[model samples]
Every structure is written in C-alpha cells, then in structure tokens.
Target: MAPVSVVMVGIGGYGAEYVAALDRLPLEKIRLTGAVEPFPTRSCAEPGLSERQIPVFPSLEALFQAGCEADLVVIASPIHHHISQSMLALNHGCDVLCDKPLGASIQEASALIRAREASGHSVRIGYQWSYSEGIRSLKRDIQAGRFGGPIRMKSVCLWPRTLAYYRRNDWAGRLRDVTTGRWILDSPLNNALAHFLHNLFFLLGPAVGLSARPLEVTAEVCRVNSIESFDTVACRARASGDVEVLFYGSHATQDSYGPRFELEFEEAIVAYKTPVGDVKDEISIEADGRRVGIYPSPNAGDHFAKLTEAVRAVTGNEPVECGPEAAAAQTLCMNGVHESISEIPTVSSTLRRRSVQPDRYWIDGLDGDLRRCYERGVLPSEAGVSWAIKGQTIDLVNYDHFPTSENHA
Candidate 1:
C-alpha cells in the first residue's frame, strides 16, 4: 500500500538495473530505504553512486538496525549470495524479489523455501519472462486452443561470450563453495540456464509432471575461451509433452538470430525473435487447416515492472506465480540437464520426471570435503581448485578479464 518499503543489495551492474527500475517506478509506491555492500570502500569510492542520496550500509544487519523496515528486499547480489541474502531478508520479515537462478542448487533453494514457509512471507523469483506481455499473450492463445489440440515447444538461445567477457571480472569463473571452504561449479545449471527452462514450463504448464519426461538430452559444451564454465552449451532435449518437444539453447555464437525464444505447435508457429526491445505481441495460429493471427493488448510494464507487481502481491499477502515452489521445479529441470551432462552414462537410463539425487560430484574430493567448502561459502581459488562441478571441471583456469576500471570506463 504505502510505497512498499524497499532495501536493495549489491548495487553494481545488474543491481544497478534494479536501482534504476525502483527509481523509475512510483517512488511514492516503492521507496529505496537503504542498501548493503560488503565492499563499502569500493562501492563508496566508485563514482556511479556519487549522486545517490540513500545511505549505504556495509552489512544487512546494519541496514536493519538503521530503521530500514523494508517490505521488499530486492537481491541483485551475486549468484552465490542470492540464497543467503534471501534467507536473511525473509527471516527478518521482509518479502523478497530475487534475481534469477534463486540458488546454486535445489538443496540451497529448499532452505530458502523452508525459511519462507516458516516466516509466512512471500518470495518471488525473478523469472520476468513469464510475466512479459508477449509471453502472456502466447500462453493465452495456446490455452484458447488457437494452436489446436496438441502443441510442441521449441526454445532457441544462442549468444556469444568472448574471452574478454570472462577476463573482465575476477569472479566470472570463480566458484563459491560454502562447503569445505572450497569453490565448485555444483550450481552451474541455475547460474546459467534457470530462466530459459522455467519459461518453457510457464508457457506450457506442468510439462514434466504429466504424461511426458525428458527422454534424452544431447549436450555439447564448447570452450570458446579460458572461462572454467562452458562459454557455450548447446543442448537438444527430447521430451514427451503432449506430442513431442524438442528444445535447444546455445550461449556461444557471433551471429544470434532471434530474441532467444520460439514455439512451434500443431497448428501454427509463434515466435518472439526481436532483440531486447519493445515489440508487439503477435502470434500466427492455424487450426483445422485454417490460419489466424492475433495481436496482444498493450501493457505498461516490462520485466522489472512485472517484478514490482510481484513485490506488491507479496506485501499484500497474495500468492506469487514465480514463488519458491515454482522456483524449485525450475531448479529441478536445471539440475536435470546438469546431472545428465555429468552422468553421461555410456547407456541412457529412463527415470521418472523430476528425479534428483544428492550430487557430491559437483563438489571436489570423492568425500564430503568439497560440499563442506561450498557450505562455508568460500571462493573457488580458496578451495584448492580453479573450478569444480560435476559434469565439467577445470584446473588453473584464468580469471584475468577486462578490469573493473575498464568496465566503468
């Protein structure tokens, strides 16, 4: 109601984007109370926030003590800090709007879910694609049977990350192991492809839960440069969702064709292939050997704007579409791809939908040592390895990238 009180964590890069969204929104409806950054020296010394008037607290607790009673805690923190920061915020009675890939692993994500349930507060994962006007229109059309009885889904995501991209930040390839004080890639799936997978389910609805499972997955991990993690991952997932669904995504390419999402159904083909800009939500559907086109009504908000609405829903005691449960399901799908990649069994096995096992391979050491490092929340270099995860592992990887100075310059 009264301008959802808000505190933001990590005000650099993506965090800065949230800051701008908060500023652009009705300031009277959402207030930026305070912010938290561990490196106050770097943050304060940086010229980006020179004009920002809000006080910058060095710790989460410090902000709370300073009377920052926020109804919303928007975590734009690093991928690793997302879970911990979200837990702290919910525990402190603040509703949360988290960046995508809520946690590195489903295990970590479960902890956040437990916290939210215990606190009885709302939590929204930042899968803004599900909220996009274009996506919503497509979903509506599909439900209306505009595409006919059976539907097939196809997701194409091809983007290039140059060697310079990884060299730009020390944390780029560095794994954060909270266990054994070591860094590992145990959570790569979430950090990399959570949104892409989740958007599929959001559009289609309970895909894996029903009659079909991901029968087989063929993945190709390409190392375009020195980044420990795969700079480009192309996967072809074959599943039985109503008819059959073939999905593909590749994050390595100089020539990217479309907006990273498209769907082909039994009747017609619907696509969203423009760059990241405003576009009319239009779909071409064919049924019974007849073709039809539909245009979506106009809406004022983009992804972040939809996120603000979710925050309001949480504050108003309403259920969130992208809540923890949905997030966990998304995480499960993400881990499925990771597990498939790791356990590249010479023989493929058929299992029920949503099957996840405890993965220590993602940790270093055959034993619990790497898990211990991850639980301790130490950076990768401290864990005696450059990067470690189940399906992929690399040693002595280079973290040199464009300097922060250059990024700002």
Candidate 2:
C-alpha cells in the first residue's frame, strides 16, 4: 500500500513536535506531502526540512489549490483558525488531527462536526494525554465501573508565563481576534494548560470518544495581565449525575507548579502530585495508599500516540480514542467560564507584582491561593476568599452557541 500522505499546517511552536514525529516515521508509512507555514524559514522545525525536499505552502488553501492532496492534515495552528482550516481539510476529503481544546468555541466544534459528517471524514482533537497509554489504561478502568461512582475531581495548573509568551502573536491571551473579530479565547485554561483540564472530562466521558456533558458551570475569572481575557481562573462544573469537576489554572504565578490532580470516587481515590519546580507531567494513579499504576509524563516520548492513533484511524478506518466530540467538553467548559463572569476582576494594586527577567505581572501569593482551592475541591467563592465573587451558574444543558444572545433566558 502507498504511504499515507500528510500535510502539516503551522510548523513552529508545538508544530515542531509534529514535524519531528513525522520525521521519525518511516517514509513508507507516512509521507510528508507539504507544510503550510507562512514563515517556514523562521520556524523551529527540526532542520533538514529543506533537505528532505518537502514542499511548503503559506496557507492551507494554497497547498490544496496547488493540486496537492493529502490523506491527513495535522493542524497546529492558533485557536482562531481551527474551525475554518479543519473544515477546509475535511471538505477536501482529508482527515484532520487538530490541536487541543478542538476549536475556539462550542459553535466551531459543532460546525467542524457538520463538515466532517458531510465529507465522511474523521476529526481527531490533539488532547495528547487522552491518547497516552497510561491515561487510556486508567480510562478503561473508570469506564468499566471498576472505581465505583465518580464523586468529584479537581486539577490545578499554575504555569508562569512571560510577557513575551502572550505577545508571541496577535491572538495570544486574546478573547477575540482584534482584526477579524473571531473568537480566540486564549487563556491559561484554554491554551497552555488545557490538556490537564480536558483530561478530567475525557476520563469521565460516557464513551471513549465522547466526554460527559457539563450540566452547569460556576467560575471566577480575574486578570493580573493586561489581556482581554483573564490570566487566572477557577471553575467548578457539574456533570450529569451531579458529579463535580473542579479546575484551577493561572499564568499569574511567580514559579511554575502543578497540573497535579486528585480524583475521588465512591470506592477509592486516584491522584498525581508532581513536586514544585518540575516540568514533567508524569502520571501515576494512587489508591488506598498504594501506587496502583505508573506511566511516563504525558510530555514524555509517547505523546506521539495521538499522531500515530489519528494516522491509524484514517488509514485503517478505526475509531479514534479522542475525537472532536470528546474535546468539545473542554471548549464548553471554557465558554461557560467566560459567560459565567459578567466582568473580569482585576487583582488589587497592592497585591500585583511584576517580574523583569522576561517581564510579567503576577498576583502575589496567588499560586498558594489557587492551590488551596484545588486541595479542597472548591472555587474561590466556595472557599470564602474576601475578594471572591460567585459567578452566575450557567446552565450548559442545551447550551449551544457562545456570547449567548440576550434572548437566552
């Protein structure tokens, strides 16, 4: 059989990893048909892209219009372009492996879903942890009801971001595109640390490819950074059956921490506690004081499982473990987050501090505060913080579009 033809869009940043994965595969298994990168020369893609003599195009349309076809298109582009680019790929009769949180809004996810169905193509979202062997092993147990009923789950990710990180492109930390006015909604929970938040929902998914629907959400959103969206957020979403999922994420930290989590069930508890100052997200499930299972950090060598799984699904006509439907749960959670808060709160001037090495403003002592909320499985309002404002409880049942119209009652 001929190699599965591939075209990778967005070759810089995380896209570099996808290129590396492609390079690792034998050319006979998956061929690099072309790349869609406006700045192929500046991207940090592994060297020898030119030596490989692979073609590169500035945009997806240009690649397809050049009469170049592909079996799969791996998209690592920004949040705003996810829907348009993905629908284009599916319409062209190509499968897609789009990066995580699927698209910018729940509406986009639905649109992509329609496009995939119309084209009879598959769409896989890049929530890599869901594809990891360890996570999959754990999900199987949870799905089989071995853990009894899930009680509640909480996750915390306090990664610090320099000013340059948000300034990287036009959409970084933005809620909407300034020029195009499209929903971007880039934030800590939506972008950098999104995988961990998505993992909770994915693990609780009704099926391997379908995440549990969030019935309602209550969230606190605040910003220490001067971005349209908040830099820090703590949200509690109630899934069907009254199961609770709590998340705490912030870029307003002086030091990097967490992605740590604790999930409680009727019979036992599973948890991962990475020490402070460590970047690796190695996952191990502990129950009843014993380490039940262990797997390498999702960031370890095996995360390419997402890519490999998508490729196999496209070529073999098998089911993808995590698809757009499953990933849409995270997007819904994020959308609810923005909608819950009528207005974002800014930290008090006395508590805001700035760092200069790379230049960023952080809310002093915020890491510990968010950690406390995670430890207790509560949001700031529930924890009785003085400045906390309890956001409106958004009914996510039948919640379809975002920036919900005033007629929504």
Candidate 3:
C-alpha cells in the first residue's frame, strides 16, 4: 500500500495538533501533501512545515485549484469555515476530518451530510472523544442494554479563560464571526467543553455512529466577561426517548474544575471525574446500589486517533465512528439553545469578581455551585442561585436552519 497523501486546513491554533500528529505518524503510511493557512504563525514553527518542506497554501480553494492531490483533508479551521472547506474537500474526491460541533447549526450539518452522500466519500467530524475506544466501550455497554433504561445525565465544566485567550482570535467569545457574519456560537457549551456535551448524546446514540437528537432545549446564558457572547450557560435539553440532558459550562471562573459528568440509568449510575477520590478520572459505575471500581480506561489522550481513524476509514474502506449525522446532535442543541435564550444576559455585577494577571472576571461561588448542581442533578435555577436567570424552551424536532441574526444580544 502507498502512503496516504494528506492536506491540512488551518495551521494555527488547534491546527497545530494535526500538524504534530502528521509529523508523528509514520511517513510511509502518511505523506504530507500541503497545508492551507493564510497566515502561518510562529506558534506552529517547531518541526514546522517550513523545515519539513511541506507546501502551505493560502486557502483550501487554492490548494485544490493547484491540484494538490490528497486522499484525506484535515480541517481545524474556524467554525464558520467548516462546511465550505469540507464541501470543497469532498468535491475534490478527498475524505474529510472536519473539527467538532460540526457547524453552528443543524442545517449546516445536514448540508455536509448531503455533500458526503453526494460525493461518496468519508466525512468524519473531529470530536476526539468519540473516536476513543474507552468511550466506545462505554457506549457499547449502554447500547447493549446493560445500563438499563436511561433516567438523566448531566455534565459540568468550569474552565477559566483569560483576557488574552479571548483576544487571541476574532471568533473566540463571539456568537457569530465578526467579518464573515457566520454563526460561530463559540462558547463553553459548543467549543472548549463540547466534548462532554457531545459525549452525552453520543453515548446515548442508538447506533454506533449516531447521536441522540435534542427535541427541545431550555437554557440560561450569561457572560461576566468583556465579550459579545455569553461565557456561562446552564442548559437542559429533552432528547429523544424522553431522556433529559443537562449541561453547565462556564469560562467565567477562577477556580478550574470539572469536565466531569454523572449519568443515571435505571440499573446503575455512571460518573466521570466524580468526587470519589479513588476513581476521579475513570469511568466509574455503580450498579444496584454498589460501587464498581474503574474499568480499564481507553487511551483518550491519544487524540490523534481521530486522524488515524479517518486515514483507516478511507484507505481501508471502514466506517467512520463519528460522522456528520452523529455530530449534528450537538449543533441542534446549540441552535435551539440560542433560540431559547435570544437575549443573553449579563451576570450581576455585584456577584462577579475581577482578577488580575490576565484581566479576567469570575462569578463568585459559581464553580462550587455548578459542581453542587452536578452532584444534585439540578440546573442552576433549581439550585436557587441568586443570579440565575430562567430561559425559554425552544422545540427542535425537525429543526433545521439557524437564522443569522443578532439574537444573542
């Protein structure tokens, strides 16, 4: 077998991960064809494309126009650029591994699905956790009916972002891209902490490569930061089969805690990063009122499995574990969330505390409160938080298309 020629879109930010992975992969099995980055920064200078003599183009369109033959194209571009680039790659008879939250809306995701079908090529979404054998093992058990009827599942993550973090890119804290006016919806729910949010639906997926659809979403969204979009959110979604999914994500905190989750099933309760010291990082399961120790975990840290799986999928004609249809669930919930809370509120000034070093602000007691909500299986509104705002519910059944308007104001 010959080496699979690969092209990468977006070589800065998270694109650096793909670059390093490509470098680490065996050269005989993987050949670097080119890259698409209008501005190649020094951040990706180490063992860099320049040193490797890998050709870098200004855009994916340019690469394809130059007839850069590639079997696979890895996209780590801005959220707004995903659909366009993936469609181009597919049109050029190349497989795609576009990055996560597939796009800002379910409609965009559907278009990519259509493109994949039309092109007769593999199109994988880069949700690394979905490619993990550990998570796959967990999902298998759930699908096998070992966990019994689903009750409820909730996840909480409070990762603090500094001023510079938001300032690094134009889309960081935005509800839409500034220049392109495309729906970005870059927030903790959709961006940094999306793995946990998407995991809930992915695990509950009836099949190996699908996710539970969010039928309706209710959410409270606010920001303490100096950004256009909300940095904190508490969302409750009613998925298919009457399963409840709750997600609490916030970047407006100093205390960094959790990407933790607790999933309740009739026969057992499963948790990740639970308060239990002995099994903090493992997928801990408690069945029939007794706790079972952690199972042999999946090597989730080997995120390059996303790329490797995509390579295997195309070269070996294997099914992609996470495709456009599977990734659309997260986009659906995100679209409904924005519609549910069109008016993003500002967290109470009195409750927010400012910090130095990077000029960030945080809601006092928020991290602890979110952790408490996770343990208690409740939303922040139900937990009686002083600054919590109740939001409307938006139905998402047969939901498609996200109106590109300033609704998040």
Task: Count the clashes in each prediction.
Answer: 26, 0, 0
Q: Whole-model lDDT, candidate 3?
A: 0.83
Model 1 C-alpha lDDT per residue in residues 1-409, reported as the tens digit of each score: 4777788888766777777777777767776778887764454323444456777887787888887778889887767678888999988988888888766555677788789889988778887765666666666666677676445555444443344545544556444443443333422345555566666656665431111234444443333334455443433444445443333333333334333444667666665444346655444444455645644422225758555775567546554666666665455444444444543221111210111231101111212322233234322234553232223321101211112123357
C-alpha lDDT of residue 353 in model 3: 94
Candidate 1 lands at a TM-score of 0.70
What is the TM-score ranking, best to worst? Answer: 3, 2, 1
Steric clash pairs (candidate 2): none
Which predicted model would earn the best lDDT? 2
Give candidate 3's error at residue 293 in angstroms.
5.4
Off by over 4 Å in 2: 275-301, 406-409
> In angstroms, what RMSD does candidate 3 have relative to the true structure?
2.3
lDDT of 2 by residue, 1-409 (tens): 8889999999999899899998888878898889998888878773567877788898999999999879999999988888899999998999999987687789888888888889998999888888777777778888899779999988898898889888888788888899888889999888988998899898898777888888899999788888888888899999987999999899988887877878788877877777445634566666777767665655556778888887787669688778888999999989998889989888789888997886989987787788888888888878776557889999999899987873275
Q: Model 2: what TM-score?
A: 0.94
Candidate 3 residue pairs in backbone clash: none
Q: TM-score for every candidate vs. truth?
A: 0.70, 0.94, 0.95
Error of model 2, residue 350, in angstroms: 0.8
Superposition error at 21 for model 3 (Å)? 0.8
